[model samples]
Target: MNILELRKKAVQLRKRTWELIYNHKNGHTGSDLSCTDILVALYYNVLNQTPETVGTLEADTYIQSKGHAVEIWYEVLADKGYIDRDDLEKGYSTFNSPYIGHPTTDVKGMEFHTGSLGHGLGLGVGVALAAKMNSLKKHTYVLMGDGEQAEGSIWEAAMAASNYNLDNLTAIIDHNDLQITGTTDSVMRSNPISNKYEAFGWNVIEVDGNDLAALIHVLTSENNTGKPRLIVANTVKGKGITVAENRADWHHKVPSQEEFEEGIRELDAQMEALNHE
Candidate 1:
């Protein structure tokens, strides 16, 4: 898909995100909205894996380390033919549903059950190292929330990734800067994120996470430096929605019917503007 098409899809994802949360009456709304563009860029335009390749060792792997935002991931997986869209919309977060609050292997595209913060990078390192050990041409990409960066294990994985020189490994931080209680700055101060990763001997690239064109360009860029890659994606929590944008309370707050309708209208306007552009 072209950049314009991806942009439109992102808007749709944002709207769908709201719908899912509104219907289910629970989700990491702000966090999910914040990273929709990153997920869209990776699944639709960047990753070398498809629904078929996703199950094989030869395919690139992705893990949502910040798993509370699994709603958006589920949507992307369904769109990519990895899961049934009807099943997702109906069974998500329901009792006995595979679509729990986090990414799970029971879902067709998920490689691991993630929801416990800070373990994703470590898992990605293991996968990347295994690929190297077997001489496989696979990449491991892990998406993390900036709030989750407060966990010490992420740094440990960073150090290991650099020590092993895992060029096929990539970590994309959804640096929306908002957590459940407050701003990431006020919560844990993981600022200077790029410098922190660079100090750990990884290649760091910062970009506007919501910009699909920019995300696609950066995510698809070639890497020959033999170093692990980190993209600090600065984003707005609850991005593309007027009321929830950058608001901390929307972290897990479900929107009322009016708010949901308003959010959809706002996304529609953005999509229309992008279409014209």
Candidate 2:
């Protein structure tokens, strides 16, 4: 898809997220919104796996390190045909549901069950190393929250990825600036993200997290850079909703009926604009 089309799809996905969460009365609303564009770019442009071959070893892998945004991931999976939309809308985060609050490997396209904050990069590093050892051509992509970077384990994994020269690994930080408690700076400052990743010996790129064109360009260019890559995606906390943007309260807060309607309308307008462009 072209950049404009990708943006339209992202707006659609954001609309779906609001609908699903509002319908189910559950989800990490702000975090999910913050990561939607990056997710759209990956599933639509970068990642090589599909619902049909998600189980195959040759397919590329996507691991969500910041697992609270599982709602967005689940929605993307369903949109991509990895799972039925009915199952997603009905069973998400419920008892015996495959769509839990965090991603699980049992889900057709999920590479890991992550929600713990600091563990995803380590898992990604291991997957990248294993792929190198086995001579597999598959790439491993992991998404981490900016707040999650405070965890020491992420650095440990960062060091390992650089040491092993895992060029096939890409870690994108959803730099939404807000976590569950408050702004990331207030909770635990992790700024200078691009510089920090560079210090860790990885190639770092900074982009507007919501910009589909920039995301696709950076990701595609980084693929053959011969070094582990980190894209620090600067994003708003509640990306698609003007009223909720960068508000910490919306991190997991469900919108009221009125707010939900407004959110969907806002996304629809954005989609319409993209379509016209």
Candidate 3:
């Protein structure tokens, strides 16, 4: 898909995210909105797996470290045909439902069951290492929240990725600048993120997280340095919605009926603007 198309889809994803949360009366709305563009870009434009072939060893892997945003992931997976839409709409976060609050391997397209913040990078590193050892051509992509970077295990995984020279692995940090508590800067600043990753011996790239062209370019870029790559994606907390944008309270708050309508309107405006552009 073209960049413009991906942008439109991202707007749609943002709308769907709000709808899902509003209907279910639950979700990590702000965080989900923050990363929707990246998710859309990856699933629609980058990743090389299908609903039918997601289990194959050669398929590209995507792990969500910030697993609270699994609602968006489920939506994307369903939209991508990795799972049925009926399952996505009906089976969400219920007993015996493959769709849960966090990702699980039980889900057909989920590469890992991730909810714990710091463990995803470690898992991605391990997957990348195993693929390297087997001389497999697959790449592992891991998405993390900026707040989760505070964990010690993340650093440990970073160190290991560098040590192993896992160039086939890419880690994208959703630097929305807000955690559940407060602003990431005020709570625990993770600034100079790119330099820190570079210092840790990984190739670092920073970009607007909501820009589909930039994300696609970075994802497909050559990394001959033989180190893991980290993309620090600067993003707004509640990206497509006016009220939720940069608001910490929306971190996991479900929108009211009025708020949900307003959020969709904002997304529609965004989509229209992008279409004209």
Each candidate structure's TM-score, on Cα atoms with residue i matched to residue i, is 0.98, 0.96, 0.96
Candidate 2 deviant stretches above 4 angstroms: 222-225
| Per-residue lDDT of model 1, residues 142-177, tens digit only | 999998999999999999999999999999999988
lDDT, candidate 2, at 83 = 89
Candidate 2, 109-137: lDDT as tens digits:
88777888899999989888988998999
lDDT values, one for every candidate: 0.92, 0.89, 0.89
Write model 3 residue lDDT over 111-143, tens digit each, in one string: 788998899999999999999999999989999
Q: What root-mean-square deviation over C-alphas does model 3 reach?
A: 1.2
Instruction: Provide the lowest-lDDT 10-residue window in model 3.
Output: 86-95
Identify the candidate with maximal TM-score.
1
**Could you tell me the lDDT of residue 98 within candidate 3?**
79
lDDT of 1 at 120: 100
Error of 3 at 74 (Å): 0.6
- Worst lDDT run of 10 residues, candidate 1, spans 48-57
lDDT of 2: 0.89
Instruction: Give the Cα-based TM-score of candidate 2 against the true structure.
Output: 0.96
Angstrom error at residue 12, model 1: 1.0
